[model samples]
Target chain A: MAPKVEHEMHYRRLGRNVGLGLSLFAFVAIVFWLTLAKVQRGEPVEAFDHTARPSLETQDSGN
Target chain B: MSDASLQSNVTTPAGDAGFRDFVALLKPRVMSLVVFTALVGILVAPNPVHPFVAFTSILFIALGGGASGALNMWWDADIDRIMKRTQKRPIPAGKIAEGEALGFGIALSGISVVMLALAANIVAGLLLAFTIFFYVVIYTMWLKRWTPQNIVIGGAAGAFPPMIGWAVATGGVSIESILMFALTFMWTPPHFWALALFMNDDYTKAEVPMLTVTHGRKSTRKHILVYTLLLAPVALATSFTSIGGPIYFAVSLVLNLLFIRGAIKIWRRDEDEAQADKYLAERKFFKLSLYYLFLHFTALLLQSALGVTWGGF
Candidate 1:
């Protein structure tokens, strides 16, 4: 077995990986915050749930 | 060679793109302009947006702008290689492949539009989508190489950010947003033509058919002055709108006078004089055009912040 040494290329690749990881993490955080804000504002957080709901019907009719 | 060395060599191929290379594909400078104008749009709107929502919406808008830039780089790679000014762009520099840029652009465009729709409203999402399409398809693909009026129409893509920001806040368009659009739209030709006057060789080398290249420098200079004359009214008209105030009006009046003065200077210089001084007047006008827009937008932001109204209007 031989000792492995780090190369300059390894540092570059690591930096890129860290950057990508942080970007994805930030994106997820934004989505979470947005959902929280929307819910807090009392806006109906509706999505296609594959089942009918009276709330959606009432909201649609109101609109 | 040792096994570790062989493995490292295999993993890090020559010219492998770093994260910065991908960021370069986004054209951060242009994105800053988009972010600033869009932030002004959000802040100046009649209705207020939640701080988080505004932040996310702006992020998505900037991403959309970056996507357009990537697509533009992909499509313009051939011309970019020929032009000295654009020769070091990501695709031209071989840091990123054209197909990679295309895919990256497409993916970001979709994500930004969908996220913006969820974060703000559908209208903002659609406007961002249209901006991306206009810049990539209408401007970059069609208008750029085909006509001298390329920038005139292509400028609309750049102008849409504020409108989208207003839509994010108000969930619709209004007179203020339209005026903001008009301000940027009318200002583009003169800004770009001033640049064209100074960088005439880049367009000539790239066969881009700029006003200077197609219509001749003399005509281009005349066009700059004419557009500046027309732009002044639009710039001033915004001062009378709801977004306008004493500060905005005062700022706009001074900037417009300076802008028009610079344009007249550009219009007056012949090639002999321009060559003697290396297009000093044209260069100064181009630099002032930057401050001209920045100050105009900043003044609008100030008006919103001060909550002042134009009593004359």
Candidate 2:
């Protein structure tokens, strides 16, 4: 029987680097997706009611 | 040859820069200060940024900080190899190659600057780039190796983080940001000199002309006290700014007093007395010096929490 030939792989082409790249992409994608969803749903990731002054700001006498 | 030997030949020892080693290269404790002060800078700024972008900007700033650290390690590996405190660091310990450290630092520097520009603004990105250049090229490569004034000048690199943070928020510099920069800038000399006072031998052996080695411990002590005195007013005055409040002022006053006292103690100890117990006074002063910076920044946070509102930047 003829010996089998296994193709050589670059480190960048290997699972580790590819996994890392994909994971980073996934993380960014998820964040963007969630943010978009939040916007569409009218729920902000950070919602500050401008009319309702922050308690900290209101407590101060800034005049 | 066995597969193990083949793998070992292919994977050089230099390839052993582990995850922990890379993280250590970032100087995480210092990075924490960078992140916090930068966050304060962002939060206190007059112009609000999107939270996601703000978060990414801070991360890039931190990565830039880590890059600076890596470059410092790369440049100082020779001396680091000798110092007991830093002997086991990745570059010095043979875990990571020196060239690899340089490459990593350069890569991170580019990524951080570009990413920061994308995440925040050109002003912040420029500040980050300047910080990296100042820390690596100016401080680590040149000043640290050349003069006793190294700490005095090099301190500017570390001090700029708060200003950068402030700029990220306001898109420009302000008096308050300058004051924050001054506090750290002035504080750096004394804090580092105290450590250099106690660790004089390390620098001496490494042939690094730290103040303690070049000017003698007495002069170093006197300088420490003088800088501490100068730093006190600046620290105290920062509390009166829009960002500072009752809590910050109180904490700054107390911390400065304690820090000055420690410097005074170190200054007064005669050479014989200081050496009587292997520089115990100097050692204690050095420990207190670490908390000095932390306390001031913590006070700022406390003031913010205390319902004293100050617009950022």
Candidate 3:
């Protein structure tokens, strides 16, 4: 068989795939950093749980 | 399938779109201005943002701006194909499909708004959403072809970035934020009108109802001078606000004088004179207008960085 050769189109496709991957990775990193900063600033970080939490109880009572 | 046949099958019209074409769809040049003004908005706020939060918020804002750019390009692709200035854009150039551009815009719009809200605050997110809507729906879809004053009112979309940035930090609006918005809002008319004076053929060919096309170049020149006259006070008045300082005042005074001088030269000329000089005064005024806005914002950034104030206010 003839030696397989890489074409210019393959390189362009590779480049686009790499760019997309990097953008996604950067997005994840940004979200992680934002979450870390918010937590460090002592802003409340709440996720829905089936049970009641003290933080929500206090916020609701205050409101 | 054979490898050669597979390669040929994959080479469709839309298959040639590279990553850069997609970036081009985002209008990186316009996004840079959005990023810069939004950064200024964030930095000059009375309250400080966490560096990471600020960074993320600005990224999302730029994304939102880019999203709107994509949407604008998609909607305006028909006129874009007719305009000399826009003929080489991704859609008109056939590098990207129009449907692809629309989907890309909608996806980025949703992501940017939601992420900004999560990264900054609800106010910032809502402002971003409104800005996107104003640009895409109100400006591009509705006003752009309907009236000669399209750019006059449409400029509000571009002016909202700093306010959004201010909201990111302060979680609300204020006089300072409003002033920054006003500065851009007031400056946009002359900046675009100057371009219209030079690129009159583009608007004419595209039938976009630009002031120059509808009212004539002489009328456009008069409008430019009138708007520049109005712009000077707004630029100068920003200096007395909380964000303003001695440096900003000095910068604004000098720039406004040059701007008015250029506008006067433009207003005084007839088409015969302008044609002889290739619209030199108008082109020069256009170039100066870019620097005028950039330097004003830079001055505000300097005031914040140097911790200086005019002491009078």
Candidate 4:
């Protein structure tokens, strides 16, 4: 069996590139989302209107 | 128990541990704060989010918060083993191996970030990722043991949820969300320092250099009062935002007054009085701080839900 006495846990041992990549990915993804999504028109979803629908009585007002 | 026996007891492979042990590693209590604040953030946004999107986003955010907690536990296993308050945590209690916690934390972090990105836009995902990184790397690994100002600065990690929630709905940050973040960031110091007063011995034992251990109780008291004073304006200021209304204003005013009153009581007490009273005031203040956050956030929620208008900007 492999050695069990020690466990690998040092985060600093990872390459600088990996850290840079991770940081860049996080920031770039956020910026990209903001620009791309904010600039474009989003699909409109209808919200339930509490007070604005026309009453049936209004349709026969001419009578 | 013997050293060898103790080592063998806790060093069992990951499969030997129970499910609750795994859950314990996630720090569910802290995750609840994250979930609640994030929900507030999403709800307070200028745009309303679909219930499904809100649910999915919050679930991923909680997972990310949990991931940060697991990683924190893994990194802090040594200190956790020593501290009375944390000695029973899965790693320190010998139920889960450090390696397993480490692996689990990393996996959850990755999944939460990626899934949040897909579920909502990438800003929410990125914010979640950043929050995890800050808690795990910046606050846990670096600031925690290094400085007496640990809670002061590390509070940012906890403060980001509302911003992330806002990002999920609007896909960006704003002055309003920043104020929401500031409210939590400012509140963390006095809240934690109150606990530090009562639990100073535990931190001293752990050698974690909490504000109380590094600074004397008198200075810690002064610091608590000062932060509370600073916190009042920010807490009240949120009432002028879009999310704030008449209900929020009334609640914020009362909570801030109570918070200031508690801090003043803490500031005025000496060690003799504290020992005689068994730190009762400090404990009461700490408890009030918890309600303080919940009530203030809940007030904001009430304003949004009930459309309480007179005080709204």
Candidate 5:
């Protein structure tokens, strides 16, 4: 539990933060664009093609 | 070739790279399993997540898992330092400080939960948050110190990833998701017990109350056999859901049979016999258990991809 002072970690910390932030931002933008596309096409963004489970559709809707 | 020559070649001694230590605290190996199971959960769901959103969701889920590892390391530093296998971890080895790991884990826990909520759905976010809390608070801080059933209850925390992954796409739980969760939950005890049979001394020395330490190796072997037997039915049950198919059933049936055979072998061995064979049953069973879950999930994913159903769906 000894407190180690920051000495040689400047660039490493900065690079790690920047990389994570950029990845998050890029993914957020892509998800937003996809959502918008679904909106434009008049589809529910949350709705999925449940073609394989035609029987489950009624159960899903009932729920 | 005296002091002057050595001085001329002086190089700056670099401190340990904090990033790698940070990643170590996250327990990348366990994080990979979390990511894989969560991915399978998403892929096997009847509803598909948007690829971009799914990627983001999985990343945050992995971070949540990593967050648990960090906090667990922080809390278990004492026991970790005592055990030979864990003595070299970031916190115990002094590669990273205690306060740093605690702060890092707390920050990532908040960030992952919030971002997952935004990118996916409330259910997935809430489940991820619960998973972190369960691991760090309920399991690591409590059961692990007090009881031998720690792995049994704490296993639920690791079991949540697939359920969260399913929630990310469907925003709700289903039989398939529940079965996936059950599969991991049931598989954990036997998998870990096999490891305990080999590494019992470490747990005993640390006084960690592992099954091998508290219940005796014979009882631990019996528990492993029972859990493996229980796991087989659950693994097969998934094939009756949206995720299961002929391939999944075939692979899982064979794997389960082999696993049962291995468990029985372990159950019958005594300490002397185990020593005679170099704990061969435990070691081999442990290795097979790893593949047992992976192949079952892999077969599930294959069936999901091909949209193959044996009239179950």
Candidate 6:
């Protein structure tokens, strides 16, 4: 007898997955555009700190 | 036993495992927890991730959860079928077969890890892979049948998601993520023991040595109270970190106090009185434990929001 093979995710599952993918893509696109625009206009984005951490030498270490 | 017998022992069940059964094998409830904690990890991290990468990372993390579930289902289908609590699951129900579940789990496990590496970073991908292996091989295959500490150690598998989330965003681990992991790890014993206290027979019938089964119910109750006490401090402490503030601290204090109170109330009642009356207190405690973790995580997010906007702390 030939060996049996199985596929867990089917076509319907795939189609549903694709729809979800598109929706997620759209949501991400909107957020990215807004963030980029805000950064361009010199607004500090609450989501990220653009500040660079201070170098080791800049901090007073008790020698 | 002969070598052939040993080989047959493994392969017989492997042959019967199926597709939908495999999908069912992934513990969906556990997977949802992984997704939620991971999402919180990403959200609360000091570093922000790009949206595309962030979404992809979360998606793969969810899939990693699904993969772990599938693998667990694959290995435990036999016990699953025997236990009343798990018997109705797809594999146990025979709606799908074992080999199918094994294949599905393995395939998804690879896909999730690799895709996560591509979408996010190597650390997150490696962590996801480790999470799957730990759940399947260490917890399911080995620890569950052999020891009462199965859930205690196995609980680590569930605790990895938030850490994985932290890695995906920051490409590394941190004290904050470790605290998140610790909270879940400590929370597992009481949450599960409460269910086990109520469902002791399920573990007994399946020959799984749950703490209640091995140590006796009184001991289990004691352990629950002790763990609840330990958990209360950690839960409140996490609220003081950068991601937390007054809101989270207040909520954590109130929630942990109530949680400890609930555990103590259950502990005070004799097991028979607790169970003979259909385990009402234990049941209520179990439900409350679910809300406890959610309330804490939500409060952390709320604290972050409050800090950012109010008084700009």
Per-residue lDDT of B205 in model 6: 92
Q: Candidate 1: which stretches are off by over 4 Å?
A: A1-6, A43-63, B1-15
Report the lDDT tens digits of candidate 3 across residue range B157-188.
99999999999999999999999999999999
**Any runs in candidate 2 off by more than 4 Å, and if so which?**
A1-63, B1-12, B309-313
Model 4, position B63: C-alpha lDDT score:
86
> Alpha-carbon error at B128 in model 3, in Å?
0.4
Query: Which stretches of model 5 miss by more than 4 angstroms?
Result: A1-63, B1-17
Evaluated on the second chain alone, the candidates' TM-scores are 0.95, 0.92, 0.95, 0.95, 0.94, 0.91
Model 6 bad stretches (over 4 Å): A1-63, B1-23, B308-313
Write the residue-wise lDDT of candidate 1 on B1-313 in tens digits: 5554555533334445678988999999999999999999999998878999999999999999999999999999999999998998988877677888899899999999999999999999999999999999999999999999999999999999999999999999998999999999999999999999889999999999999999999999999999999999999898878888889999999999999999999988999999999999999999999999999999999998987775644
Better of 1 and 6 by TM-score: 1
lDDT of 1 at B193: 95
- In order, the Cα lDDT scores of the candidates are 0.91, 0.79, 0.90, 0.86, 0.85, 0.79
Model 4 clash count equals: 0
Model 2 agreement with the true structure over A1-56: per-residue lDDT tens digits: 11111112232125435554774796587457545544653423234354433433
Among the numbered candidates, top lDDT falls to 1
Worst 10 residues of 5 chain B by lDDT: B4-13
Tens digits of per-residue lDDT, candidate 5, B1-313, equal: 3332232223212233356677888999999999999999888887867777788889899999999999999999999999999998988776676777899899999989988897788999999999999999999999998999999999999999999999998999889889999999999999998999999999999999999999999999999999999999999988777678888999999999999999999998899999898898899999998899888889988888887679744
Instruction: Assess the local accuracy of residue B79 in candidate 2 as a C-alpha lDDT between 0 and 100.
Output: 98
TM-score, candidate 2, first chain: 0.49
Positional deviation of residue A62's Cα in model 4 after best superposition, in angstroms: 38
> What are the chain A TM-scores of the candidates, in order?
0.57, 0.49, 0.58, 0.36, 0.50, 0.42
Candidate 2 per-residue lDDT, tens place, B1-313, comes to 4343344423325544445566677788889988887887777666766676677778889989989999999999999988888997888776578888888889889988887775566898999999999999999999998999999999999888878888877778888888888999999999899888778889999999899889998899899999999999998888788778777887888888889999899889878997788888778877787777877877776675565654432
Candidate 2 local Cα displacement, residue B78, angstroms = 1.3
